[model samples]
Target: MHPLPAILIDGLRATLFRHPRVSATTVGAGMFVAVVVVYLFASILLEMAGTSPPWMLLPGGVLTVLGDSMLTLIAAWLLAVLAARREAVWGIATVLLAATVAAAVVVHWPLGELASYLVLHEHAGLAILVELVARCWWFFVLLVFAHWLAPRGLGHALGSAVLAYAVSAAAWWWLPQSPLVRTMPVVQATAEPTSGDQDGDAKTATEQDEADDDDAPGAKSEFDAEAAMYAQPALLDAALARLKPQTPGKVDLYVVAFAGDAQQDVFRNEAEYVETLFAQRFGAAGRTVVLENNAATVTTRPLASWTNLQRTLATIARTMDPAEDVLLLYFTTHGSDDHQLLVDLDPLPLNQIGPDDIADALKTTPAMRWKVIVVNACYSGGFVDALRDDSTMVMTSARADRTSFGCGADSDITYFGKAFLAEALNRTTSLREAFDLARTSVDAWETADQKDAKPDAKGVAGVEPIQHSEPQIATSASIEAKLAAWRRTLHESAAVPFAPAGEAMSRGASPSPDASTRSGKG
Candidate 1:
């Protein structure tokens, strides 16, 4: 009834020449006849090649050919049906081949043996020979003649027959000998207990329990003690505290997670975990804002409308203090081409966020001091080109043209985010060291699946000390001061000359600044 099945039937009919080639009716009829005839001939040839005999030859060969023809027809019909249903063509072809081989093994071996016995003992070869001659020469030949007599010619039908023969031959050569080929079933019979199957029942129950445990959410918690410890609030607190200055007032932490689809639960979970880390590390005496997909209140506006994001950025720029000692921003979401961040909108386009938009947002907050932005998404390295400044440090999950994995719908978190946060919290590692470890972990995880996922950091240049009026107070020894010093050194090591507007515009080159010499004072 479907168009695909109709097309298939019409094609075969036209090829067969039941109707005239030029005439509409004969065109459809000819194709059907061609496919059927070709398939039959190919099946017969394959069976004859597989088995040959003098005593068992005639009748056994006839029956084998008949059975194989039927099986091939059924397989072809199944393939057509699947095509009609809009299934993948290649997958349907594979399944059809498998099914046909199974049916052939089941029907051929026993029938061949029986026919061989009949031919040897009772001389049934004469009847089989008569039937074969009648079918091939009379019936099949007549069918072809009738098709050719239609308004259309037999050329199309002959071509179709040739194609069918080629397909069948290929299938025959490639079909493997499976369990169905064996005359007897291969399943082993187990001894049944009479009202005393306690051990068996217990084993079955235990297996079921294990399967359930494996399927349960948070099941990994039972096995991964390190993940559990790393996720704890106390550990995060300790890690952040160890890095904080003794005279800390309020460190502003901003977390934003944009999961484009409801299917992207892994990104959502990673965002939540990261939020917990931020709260544990900076929440004691600092300001922390967690913006996730489901949260009632979010500082980062929903990207359902790009204008909302713009408004949110404007609000942050208006409210944020220019002299804030530290500002941390994290974003987890899908990414697009050329390393653009993808916002989850109703009709999501790939790589919706451009580098220009991010650059514009950063430009709005030019007065902020000691800014750190960590982006966990594919091709995130592009963000460096947009957000990198003398005072900003950027970490990205992967370079352009690479995919970051482990954020499937069912997965709780991505490999990059989980590894980065875990190592940062539990290993007492610097941000750079944590980024390196995260990259290694992500690489290993992706490698298992034959994928390459790597993370990179940029913007270790143009960093300088905050020029406050109280230089002595600002230069006091503290963990924050030590981290700033390290960042400054990294910036110095990676520094390049910063060309002004005219030269930069003419050259069309990226802005490069000596980070250690960069003045934090506006």
Candidate 2:
């Protein structure tokens, strides 16, 4: 062999075997460098494809990386202590730095793929288990390393691994808090006006919506004043008084657009579309009522608030025949980790709605026999445990621990809303069927989005699986039968055509005189 080749082979052998003359520091530094090189290469490759690195989170991505590195160092130190190793602090630090970089590189691709898979499927528990395996792979390596360095007994390795995991998990849960402020990319509106009746009644509704948009400029300045009026007790009472049930029907949907500050436009638009869709399909003209919180795109509408919601339910309950009619309530808003639905409208802070609040409202409405509730927000699955009963069917956008996606100022609807309301409902009349289709669509979209945004080479890193947002549904045993019956009656009514509910087309003008009168009688 050539002299240069022989020298390189000897050097590698010494480094791998931890030769007496070669300090642990030198070996650790080399490993650390190797990890950094891998991470940088992955980042560069991703960037070249017009994709941002997985660490580009809001508030401070650099800080998050630093936090991860710190956890690695702590774990390494714990392992050293458990193994009775007296390695230099600097050598240990270098080893940890290498471990952190290696872990980041090792974890990304799998995480992204798992996230994509989660979006397509409903097996969140399994996905999370796999993710834990990926995340803790470094610890597994560290265990073997502890034995290699110190030749300690199996007990030492196991103890070190257990302690390292406990400490690292605690630190991860508590540290690395990031603020929620991110720049939203603008997306052009893709939804078009819906098609309607032969007499052009649908055209009238579409034109009215367009007219409302055209009138936005004048209404912008008056938003504050109008918002204040909505806040007043007297104005709210008057609006509530004006609300009467329309003709008796098997089903009624009461929409509450819980406007939170995070993405006012997205929440508002989705809520409006859902109300219109439900009204048109389930005999909404007189039977459906919407209480909005934000000025949204249509400034002419009134803002809905917590107080307004309670009152609306009360009024609806008084007018509705509890035993014969069904109530479908849709809540669209932002959510917090504490499982509270955030209600916002700057200059006027509102209370967050918890599962208790929803339960209380329902309890007050003793007359509404059957209930179908849809919660569109992050951490909304927390509501299912409290709201689901023998007569109620509760559906949520995400699990209690996960955050749902697509609630941005530039977007029109959330992932859940788009899948369930806008798309699935258009294709099916059954709520159960709509939910199934929507969930599947959401999963495909999420998986595809991650794949398109982040393509990997040699599968080093995949897209960041920042959110799981596992949607959930809990239907009461007998509620399905009732819902089926309601659907039958709903379609038999001839008030509205089986048009795609809430398509961009005209929804027509206000409620007709006949609808209003029937509402009054109820």
Among these predictions, the greatest lDDT belongs to 2
**Residue-level lDDT tens digits of model 1 in 118-157:** 4323334543553233223212222342334322446543
TM-score of each: 0.37, 0.50
Per residue, candidate 2 scores C-alpha lDDT tens digits across 1-522 of: 542233233323322333222244444444444434443444434322322122222344335544554565677677666656546433554444444443443454445456435522435456556656655564565565566656768887667766766665445644523221222212122223222111111112123223333233222332465546544555444455555464464445444444443224566666667666776776655455555555432233445555566666766766665555677888877665456665544445555566766665564312355788988876688889988877789999877766677764445677788888777887778899899998888888877666566557866545455455678999855788777877776654322232221244455634212111000000
Q: What's the residue-level lDDT of 176 in candidate 2?
A: 24
Q: Which parts of model 1 are misplaced by more than 4 Å? A: 1-261, 284-286, 294-309, 317-320, 345-351, 451-522
Displacement of the residue 378 alpha carbon in candidate 1, Å: 1.6
Positional deviation of 461 in candidate 2, in angstroms? 4.6
Task: State candidate 2's TM-score.
Answer: 0.50
- RMSD (Cα, Å) of candidate 1? 29.4
For model 2, what is the error of residue 263's alpha carbon versus the real structure, in angstroms, after optimal superposition?
4.4
